[model samples]
Target: MWRTIGGMLGTDLCPNNIWQYFSWCYSFLPDGEIFYTFGLAALCWAAWNCRNRTTFEFKKMRSPFDVIYVACGFITYWAGLLMGEDREAMERGAKMLRGNAANMMRICAAPGGVN
Candidate 1:
């Protein structure tokens, strides 16, 4: 997933280093930074919600796919509410991130992944 995102954004990010991620996004994706921020925020919120549901409601833990699905929905809905010339670019970036997330989920579900 990180590889796919880095490829799309034209950066080589360190998976364990969030500072590097932020710097890379801020530098390379200046135009689409808001979308990236929103997407990450949504992902965090979704993960928190999923954690809460699992803890309090005794619900099963959500898969990576479910979390990314929620993030994509949030990004799309939020992007739709923005008004600017860069809105299209934002949407495109969000969609690309969403697609990458889906692809990562597929890879994670494959034979050598965390079955």
Candidate 2:
């Protein structure tokens, strides 16, 4: 059975149960991350290709601190989840990353902006 195969994978990273399905849907839903990564890349590309001083000034540039924070937080949290004993803790960790990532993206994309 699929459950048996999942158990054999020896780690709970795949959300093997129904509870995990709900958790992943609410938490690790990959769409947001995809959008964030692409959006950042696009912004950087547009900035580099533009001749506008205001858009291209390094001194006036926003630091990537918020993005870094969210990235590090996601890595740390997910790594911790991999070491966790049960689905609940993993779910909680995933939710934390999702929330942090969302907040971080908002900060990065705020109009008139953030640094």
Candidate 3:
């Protein structure tokens, strides 16, 4: 999923471990720590939901990018919790996240698309 995120962000996240992933995200995003924190929170929440649904309801997502889409929704809603520029920043980030995920989803759905 994190690799999917890097793809959305137009980077190759070839992190050897979770620590490297965290460090890279913390430094690479526009707002660095804040953006990394916000994105990670939403992604984790979405992952948790997916896990529960898969484990209890026996449902499966057709693609891993589904988590990214769900994370966008979560962050969009959570963005309201911020104030001033933080809220605006989060909204923008959410928009980008959602748009990127949507594009990826479409591409993956098309014939002979990138997987």
Candidate 4:
């Protein structure tokens, strides 16, 4: 199931030479190819989980909580990607996404270390 969805997504989002995208964009990751593979796999799993849960029909009024949750998820995923493989960067990115920009930037841009 995960493979099927991953294949479809790869085909749509990254056709021939998909590794190129990861290698070029995510140089921070030791193995961009593997990271992308796992990321897509996780996405497939989440999609399946959502499918198994109750489905929402023509939503009248969108829930703010749901919107916020989805936005957080999006932010987390993108920030994690952008932060590369640096533990400090990743942590800072997470904090930033959680509305701690001041602290995140402070820690992220720290000269010696991250605290």
Q: Which numbered prediction scores highest in lDDT against the true structure?
A: 3
Where model 3 places Cα greater than 4 Å from the true spot, the runs are 14-16, 110-115
Q: Per-residue alpha-carbon lDDT of model 2 for 1-115, expressed as tens digits?
A: 2221123223335555556644544454443432333323433443443325345563442434333334334444444434434434444444554455455556657586456
Q: Give the C-alpha lDDT of model 1.
A: 0.68
Residue 13 shift from truth in candidate 4, angstroms: 6.2
Error of 4 at 90 (Å): 7.5
Ranking by TM-score: 3, 1, 4, 2
The better-scoring model by TM-score among 3 and 4 is 3
Candidate 4 error regions (>4 Å): 1-31, 55-115
Q: After aligning candidate 4 to the native by TM-score, how far in Å is the CA of 28 from where it should be?
A: 11
* Every model's TM-score: 0.68, 0.26, 0.80, 0.29
Global lDDT of each candidate: 0.68, 0.41, 0.78, 0.40
True-structure RMSD, every candidate:
3.9, 16.6, 3.4, 13.9
lDDT of 4 by residue, 1-115 (tens): 2222223233333323556646532653454343455444444444444444435543432322233233335435654555446534444433433443233334546397656
- Cα lDDT tens digits, model 1, 1-115, are 3565676666666455667767777777776666656756776777787778888999885465666666666767777778786667657766887777777767777577455
User: At residue 4, what lDDT does model 4 achieve?
Assistant: 27
Error of 2 at 39 (Å): 23
- Which consecutive 10 residues in model 4 have the weakest lDDT in total? 1-10
lDDT, candidate 4, at 58: 35
Clashing pairs in 1: none
